[model samples]
Target chain A: MKAFISKNKWTLLLLIAATALMLVLAQKTYYALIIALFGIYAIVATSLDVLFGYTGQISLGHAGLFAIGAYSSALLTIKFGVPSLLSLVLGSAITALIGALIAIPASKLVKHFLSLLMIAFGQIIYLIINSWTEVTGGSLGIMNIPYLNVFGFEVNSNLKGAIVIWVILAIVLLVKHRIIRSRVGNAFIAIRENTVAARGLGIDVQKYKVLAFAVSAAMTGLAGGLYAFLRGFISPETFNGTQSVLFMTMLLFGGITTLAGPVIGAIVLLLFKEVFQTFSTYQGLIYALFMLLVLFFFPNGIIGLYKSGKTAVMKLLSKRAEATRNGGAENAEN
Target chain B: MLKIDHVSMVFGGLTANNDVCAEVHKGEIFGLIGPNGAGKTTLFNVISGFYKPTAGKVIFNGEEIQGKLSNQIAQKGIARTYQNINLFKKMTVLENVLVGCHTQTRANIFDAIFNTKRSRAEHEEAIRRCREVLEFMGIGHLEDSLAGSLPYGDQRRLEIARALVSNPKLLLLDEPAAGMNLTEKDILTDTILKIRDLGYTVLIVEHNMKLVMKVCDRICVLNHGNKLAEGTPEEIQNNPDVIKAYLGGAK
Candidate 1:
């Protein structure tokens, strides 16, 4: 129990802080909804990190998977009268299956070809979502999606919705933490670092690659399901190829492999999106320039900058301590 | 035991290995030595399941494993190291070796996510074995360091440690002492001998004849994709064909 506490102290602290913030912002419905959206985006970005960051597989098709989750859940709740919670899980699972199917062929390709395949996948899904009038309601989209109901509690208010989403996000983060520290995560990193070496060590490179995709898709799908329930609507406009690119950008801007990087990236970028809402036309250009600046100055992302800054501070502190100690010794001798 | 039965690998018109046949006994340090382009590494690739030999069978423990995938071959108790160092550069030394334990561990994504009793046991067992192998390789102290950050010699040892943690019956080492100094080579020689003593049948492809001669129980000399000679170190030293093809007819 003590070991678990020590290992998960930071996670616990973060959860507490996020819950406190949510309670404080409970009266501000707009801000609460934005925080809920941040939670959703953070989940998607972290899932993308699992694929691109840990497994070294670039996927620009996550928005498609997200659409699948959102559409599946919305349809299940609206048409079939299924419970909201069950639909969310089933939707995520369905997306995971599709992700594994996509990975079967994608695993055979490398670099830009893989990226192209993922882009094509996202485009196809977007087109389907836009044109499938009977099911997806065409470009008009599906509306009046039910709010998430957890057993007896209805997450109708923005603050309650944010709390619930953040709770799910906490669970996702905890699960990700477990997997990353385990042998399965080790296999993913090995495959990323050196395929030949990983094979030599008896790791099934293709199997792990596909698994990464499936796991990533499952998490991203959950985020999509959450988004659908939170906003009570589903649309093709939100799950376009550009959104996929945005997910990747968030992963890169925060840091790829680290757990906290994606969350940080999602929150910061979402804040930027809100700040630049007035200049919507220039948002793309500004994001592109920001990404360029980040790539140049902090290639490893914001986490990398923080780490380096920490080390610099430590170095200066040690140097000052050493100089003072030497002066004290000289004075005593004199 | 491993038996390479008439194995041949041809890349288009280039015949890398032409009907090469050899037998490696249990718990013996077998050596394959040849000058440049002798198909020694090619033969290693064939046995390790990186390539489907054009013809012939690679039988490990009496099962034909030539056409199987590399990971499948590894599952059948065959583990190999590359000619170039292939340690996961960004991963810590412990993590690199832990990856070797993948074939032995049975924890899946569900197991890992839930931290089930089975997963916890497997993880602890893997770490225990990894630490043992790192200690055996004299790299226990450097387990937390990045594999890429290690010095060249230590990286080589870490690769061996990674291979060793798999607990394979047959260990295939391709040029283990490729870029080592004399002292490092001497240490490697001792490590190889220690590995052999640990009851693993080691098939090593090496250019360092001194290290090979000192540690190999039996050495096979290849020249231009053909077996030139096969014998103990003294017998290989005196064979006229081996002397002419490999030793340059000098000593």
Candidate 2:
């Protein structure tokens, strides 16, 4: 048992078992849909962490990337008669280019200035969707988008779609995880700590900052593409500044610096979205209140609490064991 | 070798460095001593490419490096430590040293993204180098400790270790012994000489007269950004201008 834990063999086994369980559930039941949603949101949040948490740069324009991917894929496939897979690929690629272009100038701005610029960028995306009636169908939105079919397998059911999303999310998460734990990740942390010190250490801080922005943008764009096809429709209202704020809230609530924080955050938040569905109008305010509570108490977010709790539990258990042994010794001596 | 030739820097009306010229030979423990605001630090900054001279040039190993960025200069084999230790406070000591070794590592984005065998090798190599550098500075035991939480003396030593990880040919140390007590300063003086013995040239800016006189092969005295004297320590200590600079006015 010690060897298994020490060598990470047990952890690997647990992960494989969990994945197999998820796959079986995905094939048999609707539970995988929830996991799929969690997986997609996690991928987006992790990508955001690379920008805000690691690089120490914040963005309020992520929903723009998401909306762009959705709109591009939905519009290209439905209206232009492009294949679903081709549309997904082309939409994300185009979104990535657009993201890079926006990030270039966006990186030059700092703090509130950059945030204001991103908000404006997001608004522009919203306006484009609403105003361009010829292409996007304006505020009415487009629907009945075709399902993704690969080698005669149609992604028509929620379970199958969930599987597809989860697989792609897994690939993205792995790639992003490796990137963040790499030299570039170290450079990002350096930039976060002190840009001047980073510069002094012979790091090209600006280049890495821009690269981080681009990579994150690409990932968010990909998420957007997946979302569009999954929903088979997307609207201008879905890509607003309010949605971007929700994404930020998700990142913050999950734990900004943690890899799995986003998953926890997104799942909880989305579940709340469902739980509060009856009082739909009050959901936003409730969410804001919940976030404030998290911020006030768990300022480091969910992961922080988890870590501190784990330490506290371990300390308590050790103390209890020590007290028991000492008590036993005292009794014996008596 | 570093040569600062007739470098003059004027900030608006005040000339910070007025045609200051100096030569730091390879592998010499050179010292720059001056009273407060004497521009000794400014000189060190200029040589390390943190500041651009208004006129003249700094030639490092026969390459003109005046007006380049500090990071670029560091890449060109010059490393520095601040008088006020600029460590990454939140990072572990090992991570801080790895940050210093950043420029030397040649791992590309793809290598890092994929965690390739080469990248893993480089990562291990970087960790090994960081360990060696920390051990050399006698702070290897504090590798996992946060840099900000370390005691002041150890933090200073950590800064020096981090600077060494860059494999610099010339090291610019700004007041390494400034705030240490007599006993601590004695240990630091030994440390400075040990560093000099390791085939690296050290140019130090210090106000600790005892440390300056003890370790420096030659000393340059400055008063209000102007050179008062430049000679061996004994010559510097006895020069009328040096005496005037340190003790108000020489009789």
Candidate 3:
């Protein structure tokens, strides 16, 4: 426990500091709204990391999953009068089922083809939303989503709403941390590293691939439900291919390889957009520029860059130590 | 414990394995030797469930497993190493072995997310078993190192350790002595024999006759995807047909 704590102290410290910052920002509900938005994106991106980073699957269709959650939650509350929490769970489940179904056929393709398939799925979902006027309210989308009532604790203000969203995000992050060291995590990484080798070890590769889809979609769906309720409105335009690309960008920019990569990525990109809102007309160009820069400089993501920096510094120090030992000692590993 | 009855694997027009028949009995080190393009690796693929056989049956422990997925076959107490060293390159040596324990573990998604007692127990048990396997394979100190960074011989040992962690009833080693020096081959020969002592039925494929002749209890020679001959190593060394196809008339 001592060694584990020492090794991960920075991560734990960053986590606590982020929480404190969130609480301080909660004082201004307007700021809380943006924070809540950041939290929501973090949830979505973190789930995407589970697919892209650990499982080596890519889905540009996540925005479709996001839309499904939003519409299901809104429809359930508006049309069926279901409780907000129950509807959220049901919405997530429906999204997961859809994701699993899509994964079956999608998994047959290789590399960029799989991503293209996801993009196609996202387009199909957007088209459905646009054409299915009776259910989806067409391009105008559903409006007046009810505020959450968590056991009668009304989340009517941005402060309460932001707190709830961040709380969910924190729980999701913790859950991800736990899962990344567990058996299921190993299987996911194994499949990512080598599918043939994973199969040789007795892992049901297809089943696990579907499971990654279901889990990723389920989380993205939950974030969507929260987004719908928080904003009290959602549109088909918001869940388009562009939005899916934005989500993937956030994951890549922050660091897909680390536990905090998606969270940091989401927060950075979301805040970056907000800060440059005056140039919102050039948002796509800005995103593309940022993506190209990151790709050129930090292909492994920001966390990956930091890891490389650390290694270089450690190597320098170790070489100095070796010099003192008459240059006979073996170089350090790790 | 493994019987392949006329297993034939065809890749479009190419028959990689054609009507190969062999039985690997329990408590023996059975070696499959052949020259290049002789389908020794294809037969391993057939038994390990990588390629679906176009023709006949693979019976293991009296259970038919011809049409099963590779993972399904692995779950039925069969583990295998590759001809190419296919370790999870970025993962730690310990992690590589732990992944091999996937089939034996019982933790589900809920267990993982919640860090349930059942999950923790299984995880700890798997770690313990992985460590033991690493030690047995004589690479215990490399547990924290990345698998790809290990020396070639240690990497090979790590692969074996990973396979051994599953407590497989049958282990298939494809060219275990490939690229190894004479001393390394000698140690690998000892290790294969020791693994057999642990009650595992080992079916090894190798081009190196010195190691095969030293370790394998029985030998099956393959040529052009066909089982050419099966006999003891002494019998195989003297057999003119085996010598012609693989040994190139060498004594």
Best by DockQ: 1
DockQ of candidate 1 against the true complex: 0.88
Q: List TM-score (chain A only) for every prediction.
A: 0.95, 0.89, 0.91
> Which candidate, 2 or 3, has the higher lDDT?
3
Model 2 spans with C-alpha error above 4 angstroms? A1-34, A75-90, A149-153
**Best-first order by TM-score:** 1, 3, 2
List the candidate 3 regions with Cα displacement exceeding 4 Å: A1-14, A313-334, B247-251
Clashes of each: 0, 0, 0
Off by over 4 Å in 1: A1-19, B247-251
Across A141-181, the per-residue lDDT of candidate 2 in tens digits comes to 87887887765778887788887887887787787788877
Q: Give the winner by TM-score.
A: 1
Best by lDDT: 1
- Residue-by-residue lDDT tens digits, candidate 1, B1-251: 89999998999999899889999999999999988999999999999889999999999898999989998999888988889888899999999899999899999999989999999988998899999999999999999999999999999999899888888899999999989999999999999999999899999999888999899999998898988889999999899898788657665
Q: Tell me the tens digit of each residue's lDDT in model 1 across A196-278.
A: 88887778899999999999999999999999999998889999977887888888899888888999999988889898789
Candidate 1, residue A217: Cα displacement in angstroms equals 0.7
Write down the TM-score of every candidate. 0.97, 0.92, 0.94
Q: Is candidate 1 or candidate 2 better by TM-score?
A: 1
Model 2: lDDT to the true structure? 0.84
